[model samples]
Target: MTVAPRIAIDAMGGDDGLPVMIEGAARALGEDPALRFLLVGDEAALAAALSARPALAAATEIRAAADVIAGSDKPSQAIRRARTSSMGLAIDAVKGGAADAAVSGGNTGALMAMAKLALRTMSGIDRPALAALLPTLGDNDLVMLDLGANTECDANNLVEFAVMGAAYARAVMGLAAPRVRLLNIGVEELKGTDEVRDAAALLRGATDLPLRFDGFIEADRLGRGEADVIVSDGFTGNIALKSVEGTARFITDLLRRAFTSSLRSKAGFVLSRPAFHMLKTHLDPNNHNGAVFLGLNGVVVKSHGGADAGGVANAIGVAAKLVRADIARRIADDLAHFRAGPRTAVAAK
Candidate 1:
């Protein structure tokens, strides 16, 4: 019989700490009887949470550790000082073959640092990028890469990101021959800085890739279903992602206030409850909490710091799917293919 893949969760990492993480782990296990979790954190809190659910208690194995990395701690300093922190322990679990993958909602910088230091990067990958799936106007979700991970990227790095993002989209979104786009100031090839223009030229000449190069994409056209995978520098990608999140929250709050303003509106809200719920689910960050750090040797998922139990559960589900798909291995294979092809001649400025 095939053994079920084990997931290492940082129970003491997120804002809500062990309680919410444990709840999320329990929920995930409840969904799949074969799923096993390795919870890394304070022994007492983890035991208490698991003990509440007898079945989950049996499914989970706890790794007792003392330290907890705070969000405010410096990534380098925290990584060195807190060797036994939940996040560090989770990475160790994956490294030591105790788990197939790991999930964390703690310090982003610290998590990235630990992952790089512990798991390292796949061949030909200059840096591992944080890639997320965003809801788009199209039928399929758009995979955006380098989301707050690498602030400054070069032409080759962007090309590498494009390849990785395309592979992820094809595997996760089930899109054959996924359309790839480079996020830029304008859709034209001549627009943006020398870096983007150079990257666009390189992508255009990458005829060996399975992805369809769709040229440049503007930020405004991101939600309009322009491309299946959007690649950009971390600075731009993070700003765009946060802006969309803030806008989504503002719109939801406004709708809530409007719906509760009067009896008639409240009655309408009751009648439209199903539709409202669907819309909320479509826009909810919790439903899409998992952001994979692509180009790594092993699957490492980073959830939102303020994620709830549902979000954490969804992140775990994402990690499971990634592990089943062998996403890292696939990415490495694709990168190797791209590198083996004739090097594209750099376009003249």
Candidate 2:
């Protein structure tokens, strides 16, 4: 018999609050009947919301939480309310082994801070990184890491991100060995800062790693799917991610305007409706909604704050999938091998 994966949800964390979270959980439960939830939020509001979601209600158990960490709250402010806040309690459920993983559509900084404090780093991992899947030209999505979790990262950090990111690709992308690359201004080893070059040199020689360490990738080629995993410091990764999102939106809007500009264009759009619908589905943010904090002892998935029910369901799905796949163990094993194999080689040479 397969054991059901349990997820702890920060019900009041996102812009849509409990209603969307509940609806999302309901949708997820409908798809995965064996799934269960530990919903952390205000008891009265959650109960009221869950009444309409009988399937979700049956699979959920509300854990009362009085406070919510607001979107504007700083990490320092959020840590103080860790015990009382909905997001914090949801994380706690994972720490306490009450749930397999925690999913939240909340303040990213706060969630990272609280999760780090609560779960700490797995042995040998210095810092946790936020990783997510991005649609690429390939049949499979590519994994990118340090997505605003650590604004600054050193060479060692970048190498660690590669190991962790590759493990993530293995778990989610179903790749046996993902091709990893360092995101840089240029592909040449001579380009980029000391940190990136150093990280690249290390990855290039780390024969023990299961992943293929491609030298570098420029931001312009990210969607080409040339690499399976792209590693970057949070500052660079966040900017690149936003740039891609903006470009997608711009193209979508341009198509909309073009289709409405003339009867001829409208007729063309009608003829190509199926292709356009496929494009829309492929580019939709909801399909890739979860961003995971890797290197933590427990799994923590971040949902986009403004995501709708479909997006929220996708995030929950990601969390549940990671739990079932034992992603934490995979990362730990890979990190252990990485640390033991090339501890002195990267920096020494």
Candidate 3:
């Protein structure tokens, strides 16, 4: 963590293909020139592509991995091919200490399976949660999980998530004591299911923990700046994430239509161009492109397959930041404290 991270890039895993992935690495280097990469994919193709990117080529080493995990491949099937796949080797680089972290735009299920198998969950974590940062109107971005990792979770899982999430916020966002909330039907204590209510009770009693646990938060208030960490089962979290994304797209599209409806509207758009540009930047998925698999022994970031070069660079940046901060050790300490009994655990300053 004291020096620049050496990252392992799954170069053949994205939809836009190798070009965007390579360009993303180059872009990341342009921002932080201390980065180095272990590019895993076809040897000839990688060599040919990097020939055009002199700086990236100079900072990278190619590791030929001939196989690729298809987007349509199931995790069960893909797990068997881990030894030969590009995504697999990238993760392997992290497990083997050849790299500080791994970044891939490959199949999520496959990546999760391979990472869990290779890196294993941390000592106190039962399962690894998929967590990502969402742009909020608050002082800093919000961290939300499980985002489709655990379809169903008990009260224990929920509490564990809150601990992991709060640790993530503190380590990566530099929050001393983040406000944690359960994703529920309403802010009322009794409004959600039994599991949510039980989790809330546990969190409220956990004063010795590092976070400030509120009662509950409704999905509509996700971006309202009310909470710092949001926890939920994967099913609900995934739906809420998609709903937010869809709403952003709908609003942007609606504005596009309205702006072109008449000459006056077009002129109004021209006058309001700067505001619209800011709006676009806020709504763009590329700006929030990295989703980390929390609780693993090593850091592995999941990039959206449809991400452009900018998006991939942002994902790589997320991975690099996590590496530089030693997020894994931070989460492990919190998890260990949680596993030991809250009454015995001391609040983090």
- lDDT by residue (116-196, candidate 3, tens digit) is 999999887878899999999888889999999999998878888898899888877889999999999988777989889
**What is residue 198's positional error in candidate 2, in angstroms?**
0.6
Estimate every model's Cα lDDT from 0 to 1: 0.87, 0.91, 0.90
What residue pairs are clashing in model 3?
A: none
Return the clash pairs for model 1, or none. none
Model 3 misplacement above 4 A: 343-349
lDDT of 1 by residue, 176-232 (tens): 789999888888667998778888888888778889999998888888887999999
TM-score of every candidate relative to the true structure? 0.94, 0.95, 0.95
TM-score computed on alpha carbons, candidate 3: 0.95
- Give the per-residue Cα lDDT of candidate 2 at 317: 90
lDDT score of residue 236 within candidate 3? 92
CA lDDT, candidate 2, residue 224:
95
